[model samples]
Target chain A: MTSVQIEVFLQTLIAGLLLGGLYALIGLGMTLIMGVMKIINLAHGELMMVGMYIAYWMFVLFNIDPYLSVFIATPALFFLGIAIQKFLVNPVLKVESILPENQVILTVGIGMVLANLATVFFKSDYRSTPVAYATNAFYLSDFWETSPIELSLSVPWTVSFVFAVVITITLWFFLAKTDTGKSIRATAQDLEAAFLMGVNVKLMRVITFGIGAGLVGAAGCLFLPIYYLFPSLGGQFTLIAFVITILGGLGSTIGAIIGGLVLGVFESMTATYIGMGWAPVGRFVIFVVCLIFLPGGVASLLKRKKFGK
Target chain B: MKKFAPFIILTILAVIPLTGLSTYMLHILILVIMWSAIGMSWNLLGGYCGQVSFGHAAYFGVGAYTAGILYSKLGLSPWWGVPLSIVVVSVFSLVLGFIVLRLRGPFFALATLASGEVMRITTENLVDLTGGAMGILIQKRTWVDKTWYFYIILLIAASTFILVRKLMESKLGYYFVAIREDQDAAESLGINTTLYKTLALCISGVLTGIAGAFYTNYMGYIDPHVAFALHDISIITIMIVMVGGVATYWGPFVGALIMVLLAEVIRSMPGLGTAHQTLFGVLLIVIIIFLPNGIVGDYKKLKRLLGFRRAST
Candidate 1:
């Protein structure tokens, strides 16, 4: 490849890597919920939208930075998650229906209400948090005067990436160390087994759901400065999260992280090479391809390797 | 009364145009019939077969576009789309079923949903064939009066109702119910679950596609948004089945009437129009929690509750 071609490729890769880290954050919540509850949270993106709205209002009213609003939004989302689980989902779980997909349909309804209500109250406007350093960037040429090519890193993307890493590490530490976290994992492995082992499966389900909501809420806050938001944006992000969960092997956290990176890079590549409109198609191409060839997702491959079967 | 109820209702609907009702009312009736037709098609797959699809719009859009293409590109009448879509939608459904039928429950639902969205996006990008985002507009409409359109849709809806009823009474219907009750057991009983599931998907998809082709001719407009709508076409189809009653012959009809009337009433209210989806969402939640089997499915329970209330009062 020519110098310009190589530079373009490198630029796209860097941009994709930054985007992927954030995507992983979004996917993490969905994977966690699917793991513990054994139900896909179709309203995952709407919950993220709520978190973004909260951050937007905090920035507008209280003059707080988007990053700092994470602290506020996360806990609020945790409570919201608890309420939804207690009032809406738990009841449906007990309801006898021909179709076992009632919970999924219920989530779709919740998403519709959330999206429509936002449009009603917020007037369907595209919004963003206007941080002071929105355009602040670090240039490769500045750091290395003898550099052959130019590169710029936006301040917000880098900051978001770092925050995502830190949060993921914290999640790892908690899940690996804490008793509640262990119980949650145990429940995910085998619900009946966990119950037999004297773990409070009901409580763990609620807490896992809350943590999922809280984590995605933090992800929304991280995304606020870099991306624009509207109420309907949740639907697309919901698809993105769903795709990631599938790619990552249903409820596997590590798989979700890898799937997020793969999707992010692939999406950006299509946006750069193909026209922008075809990017969504690329996302689905990856999804359909994964479904057909690797139905068990990346986690299955990991399992195969570990088991040496 | 129960035995002759369908014929009586069909006769009443057939004669409604002669009543000199206003054009607006005729339009509403047309919509109600069309939606019920779509709902019945959905019910065939979702209710009896237990394969809930969230992307009937994919078939719907493809059907609309088929007719639209015939009129605009082939210089043929839009009516050709109705017959041709049977062949077209069956092929598409077979392909779609091959991929989606592998997954069960919510995964299947999600896969279908994505397929609808993918078709929309593909159509939007295929500007030459689909006219891009501008969509297709038939310069001439089939008729200026609403009566012909009403009768045509009514005919379609009636046939659909009959087809579903006949299918349900046959051995095929028993197979579907068995698969729904337990796939593993059905497989053990030598019922090729995959073949039956694929058959159900094709029938349901073809039926919805026919309705869509009818929609294109009736509306004289075909856009990716209107034809392949997720919330509007797909969700509403599911909602009809959900509200009316799953797996019941008359549920789709009842649900369609209520939903259509509800939409019209809500849309007429200037303030409540934007909040319609919120109401829909709340209704869905309440039904899932309280009714679970929809109005027709749980009407006995509903009536008992009402009777108890009357006794108390």
Candidate 2:
């Protein structure tokens, strides 16, 4: 291939990786909730949307940087998640329902309420944070004067990616080293065992959900400067988070990271090669392929390899 | 009286148009029947088989597209799409079933939801055949009156009612309930869990597809958004069964009636139309928590909550 072709491919790859960092943050939240609650939070995207709106208003009203608002939004979303779990989801869990999928359906209702209420209050108009550095990018050719290919990275994208990486590392530290985090993991692994071991499983569930919502809220803040916001945007992102979870393996943090990166690259490649509209179809293709051939997802593959070794 | 209840209800519904209701009322009646048909289909798979699909829109859209394409391309009457959809949706469901039926519970639900979005996106992208986002509009509508549409949907609803009743009564129905209650136990008992699940999916999909085809003929317009709406079509189908009663036969019917009328009442109210989903969501939360079995399924609980007491013996 020509140097120009290589340059374009490299650019796309870089873009995909940057996008994947944020996607990983989103997927991490979903995987955590799925792992601990044992129920798919269909309202996950709406929580993210709530985060985005919080960031948007912060930017619009107080002139706060979208990144800076992440602090505010994450906490707000944490409370919202706790409230939802305690009042709506927890009660349903105790109820004798004909369908085991009732909790999932309840999340759907929550999502609808969130998205619709956003429409009512926000007027459904697409909005974005017009940050000062929105279009600012660093050119690779400027630094490497003798480089064969030119590359440019958007300031917002790079900053967002850095923030995502930092947050992910911190989360890893928390999950790996902290007592509450260990309890959460134990609950996710085996609910009964965790409870028998004297761990407060219910509190862990509530805290895990809060953490998941907080992470996704941070993602929303990161995405605000780069992506358009609307009420119905929650549905699509929720699906994206879900696809990532399934692709990575249900409730596997590391798997979610890998799945997010894979999805990001695949979606960017599809957009570059085919058309923008077909990018979602590409996501579904990968999902179906994963379901059929690799039912256990990347986590299972990693597990099998470790077992073999 | 219990045995004759369905017949009695059908008879009353069949003559509703004879009361010479306004066109708007007839339209609402048609919508209620159509939703019930979709709900019954969903009830079979979700309520009976325990496979709660969040993507019935995929089958529904395919059915509508099947009918729309026939009229648009083959010059056949759109009514032919109903029967043709049974075939098209069955094949589609079988293929989808192969992939999704492997996953149980919530995983299956998400997979089906993805499939619906995929179908919508596919149709939206394939502009030449499906008319893309512009949608297909029938040039010559079969009738301007609402009575015929009402009758047609009523007939479809009745047939779906009968078919579901028969299926649920037979050995197949028992297999479905067994699988729903406990798939592993059912398998241990030598029930072909996968086959029965697929069967449930096919029957459910075909019935929903038939309703979708009817929707196209009734509405005289076919669009990817309208036919494959996640919230409008698929969620409403779930809500019908969920709000009415999950496993009960009468659940979808009563749920459809309440939901359809509730939607109309909400939408017609000044300044409240835009917030209808919020209200629906609240209702859903209340039903899930307080009446998890739905109105019909948890009638005793509801009656007790309402402070109704049985006469002293």
Candidate 3:
């Protein structure tokens, strides 16, 4: 390939890696909720949207940096998630229904409400953080004058990627070292067992939902500088997160991270090779292929290899 | 009187267009009927078969586009798209069913949702065939008067009601309910779960498609977004079934009526117009929590709850 082609390829790869980091964060939240609740949170993306809106307003009203808004929005979203679980979802779980998908539908309702409220309060017009350094980037040519190819990474994207990695590491540590985290993990593995151990299964479910919401909210804050904000945009992200979870194998955190990177790279390739509009199609294509060929996802394969299956 | 109630309601509905009501009311009635038909189809799969599809718009959009394409490309009347969509949507659902029917519960629902998005993106990109995002406009509507349109939709809705009622009473319907109640048990009992699920999906898709075709002809325009809308067509279909009555015969119709009226009221509110979805979201959450079986399914509970409050008052 020509030097220009190589440069384009490298740029796309770098962009995809950056995107994957944020995607992993988004997927991590949904997967965690799915793990503990055993119910798909359709409003997962909307929780992120709520986070984004909070960040947007923080920037608009108070001149707060989007990254700093993460601290504020994450806890607020956690409480919001708690309220939804305690009120909306808990009732649905108790109410005897013919269809077992009531909680999922309830999440859809919650998502709809959140999205519409945003549309009402913050119109449908697309908005983005006008961070001064958004355009600032590290150029290969600037670093190496005699470099064979040219490539650049946007400053905000690099910062967001770094933040995502740090948050992911923190999440990993919390899940591994913390008592509440272990309880949450135990609840996910076996609800009855966890209950038998006096883990407060109900409280764990609520907290898991909160952490899931908070994680996605933080992802929203990280994504704000690099991505545009809109009310209805949540649905697309919801699909993206769903795809990542399926690709990563239901509730596997490590798998979600790997799936996110693969998806990001694949999407980047599609955008570069095909067309920008087809990027969403690439996401679903990977999803369908995963369902067909690897129904268990990356997590299952990892487990099988470890077990020598 | 109870047995004849459906016939009585049908007769009343048939004559209402003759009462010289305003055109606006007629328009609203048309939407209610259209939505009712779609809701009934959804109820069959989601309520009875226990397959809660989140992407009925795939069929709905195809049905609309089938008619829209006929008018725009084939130089045929859009009305012909209605009958044609039944065949088109059935075949379409069968192909889609091969994949989605493999998964159960949430996975199946998400797969169907993905399929709807796929159809939408395909249509948007295939501008030559579908007019893509530009949409198709039927320049000459078959009838300027809304009477014929209303009658046609009413006929569709009435037939849908009859078909649903008869199907539920038949063996096929029993199998659907059995699958919904317990897939493994049904399978152990020699019910071909896959075949039955596919059949249910086909019928459900065909019915929703018919509504879509009718919409294209009545509205004289078809677009990917409107036809295959996730929230408007798909979720509203679920909401209709959830709010009215999940498995009841009259549930879809009642739900559609209330929803359409609620929409009109919400839309007319000046400052709160954009918040209509918020109201719908609230209503759905309330229904799921308070009346999980919907208004008709939980009739006794609803009545008792109201009666107890009345007695206290």
Best model per lDDT = 2
User: Candidate 2 — which residues are off by over 4 angstroms?
Assistant: B308-313
Q: Write the per-residue lDDT of candidate 2 for residues B241-289, one digit (tens) a residue.
A: 9999998899998999999999999999999999999999999988999
Error of model 3, residue A190, in angstroms: 0.8
User: Which stretches of model 3 miss by more than 4 angstroms?
Assistant: none
- Candidate 1: tens digits of C-alpha lDDT, residues B1-313: 8999999999999989999999999999999999999999999999999998999999999999999999989999999999999999999999999999998888888888889989999999999998999999988987899999999999999999999999999999999999988999999999999999999999999999999999999999999999999899999999998999999998899999999999999999999999999999998999899888889999998899789999999
Every model's TM-score: 0.98, 0.98, 0.98
- List pairs with backbone clashes in candidate 2: none
Scored against the true structure, residue A276 in model 1 reaches a CA lDDT of 92
Per-residue lDDT of B216 in model 1: 94
DockQ of each: 0.85, 0.93, 0.79
Q: Rate the local accuracy (lDDT) of all candidates.
A: 0.93, 0.94, 0.93
Report the lDDT tens digits of candidate 3 across residue range A10-85.
Answer: 9999999999999999999999999899888999889999999999999999999999998999999999999989
Best by DockQ: 2
Classify candidate 2 by CAPRI docking class.
Answer: high
Ten-residue stretch with the least lDDT total in model 3 chain B: B106-115
Regions of candidate 1 where Cα sits further than 4 Å from its true position: none
- Per-residue CA lDDT of candidate 3, range B1-313, in tens? 8999998999999999999989999999999999999999999999999999999999999999999999899999998999999999999999999888888898788888888988899899888999889999999988999999999999999888889889999999999999999999999999999999999999999999999999999998888999999999899999999999898998998999999999999889898898999999999999999999999999999999999999999
